[model samples]
Target: MKIVSEKLAQDQFTQLKLKNLKTILAESIAQADRGELHNINDVFASLTKDKHEDISNSNI
Candidate 1:
């Protein structure tokens, strides 16, 4: 039981950390957009996102 509880706790912590990271990334992008910051990594991340849409699909 102790091992299971530890695993659950670790998973929860990992989720929270990922959520925080996404929030920070969004804030960094917003700040960069406003000209309040300059970080190439953030800029690159924003630009390199997968934007491929189903534009070729006839269903649309």
Candidate 2:
């Protein structure tokens, strides 16, 4: 039935997403072990600055 097929497709998609997430997590752990990291505050500050700049540019 269509419903069964749709469910199977959704399950496959979920599995794929989980696999991708696991891969990303492993890469992140490896990067951390290599001392490749950023400060959270700095990241947020950069984002905030960029957002403000975007708003100012839009007003022009």
Candidate 3:
């Protein structure tokens, strides 16, 4: 995921919308701490699937 992290660092969407990696990681950790951990792995796997069908679906 090094390439993905590099892409995110240079991504215009991330720059305009979010500030930096620390901010994003903090928010994600907070959400995960709030009882949102159960499906995190499964959800991530589903979303990052080759076809990425989960992203097109609202269930994610």
Candidate 4:
């Protein structure tokens, strides 16, 4: 009984430190829709070339 309680406590602690991805993504998407997300990707894109630049030339 004591061991089970200890394991449960450990699992709860680990879970607390883990991310809730669904909640996080929902919040991020909501913020983006509301224009609250900073969305600085364009700033970084200028530093790199188009990722799909070779897509058109591919033989696939």
Candidate 5:
């Protein structure tokens, strides 16, 4: 009985995650349709810069 309940809970969590992912994808599509887009390279570069800044700050 305990095992079954645990499995059910895990399934519910998985479903919730999938639903959230769908919502995010829909929002991204709408944004793209409105010409609100970003360059992938720029996003990566920004993330890398932030990570480097974090590391440098930690050293101080």
Candidate 6:
């Protein structure tokens, strides 16, 4: 009986932690969206730069 209570308490704590983590993640995503993060554009530009460099090297 005591062990069962302990397990339940642990489960509740874990659930609470997960809920907090989810809230934090949601807030982070909202902030990123508000900031208009350009990670994708940056990645595309970097890939294009690399391709250009490759082409230049090949020509040389």
Index of the highest-TM-score prediction: 5
* lDDT, candidate 2, 1-60, per-residue tens: 999999999999889867866765676667667777465453345446756986999999
Residue-pair clashes per candidate, as listed? 0, 0, 0, 0, 0, 0
Clashes in model 6: which pairs?
none
Question: Of models 3 and 6, which has the larger TM-score?
Answer: 6
> For candidate 4, lDDT tens digit of each residue in 11-32?
9866853444345556667877
Ranking by TM-score: 5, 2, 1, 6, 4, 3
Off by over 4 Å in 4: 17-21, 40-60
Candidate 6: count of backbone clashes, pairs at least 3 residues apart or interchain? 0
> How many Å off is the CA of 7 in candidate 3?
20
Q: Identify the candidate with maximal lDDT.
A: 5
Assess the local accuracy of residue 33 in candidate 4 as a C-alpha lDDT between 0 and 100: 83
For candidate 6, write residues 18-59 as lDDT tens digits: 786676556656757788554655434544675698699999
Query: What lDDT score goes with residue 11 in model 4?
Result: 96
Kindly list the per-residue Cα lDDT of model 3 for residues 1-60, writing each as its tens digit: 999988987797657535544555566677678866566564445225624663467565
**Global lDDT scores for all candidate models:** 0.69, 0.70, 0.59, 0.60, 0.71, 0.70
lDDT of 4: 0.60
lDDT of 5 by residue, 1-60 (tens): 999999999999889867866766676667667777575453345446756986999999
Winner of 1 and 3 under lDDT: 1
Where is the poorest 10-residue window by lDDT in model 6? Answer: 38-47
User: How many collisions between residues are there in candidate 1?
Assistant: 0
Candidate 3 Cα misplacement greater than 4 A, ranges: 1-19, 37-60
* Model 1 ranges off by over 4 Å: 40-60
Flag clash pairs in model 3.
Answer: none
Question: RMSD for each model, in Å, please?
Answer: 9.8, 9.0, 9.6, 13.3, 8.0, 16.0
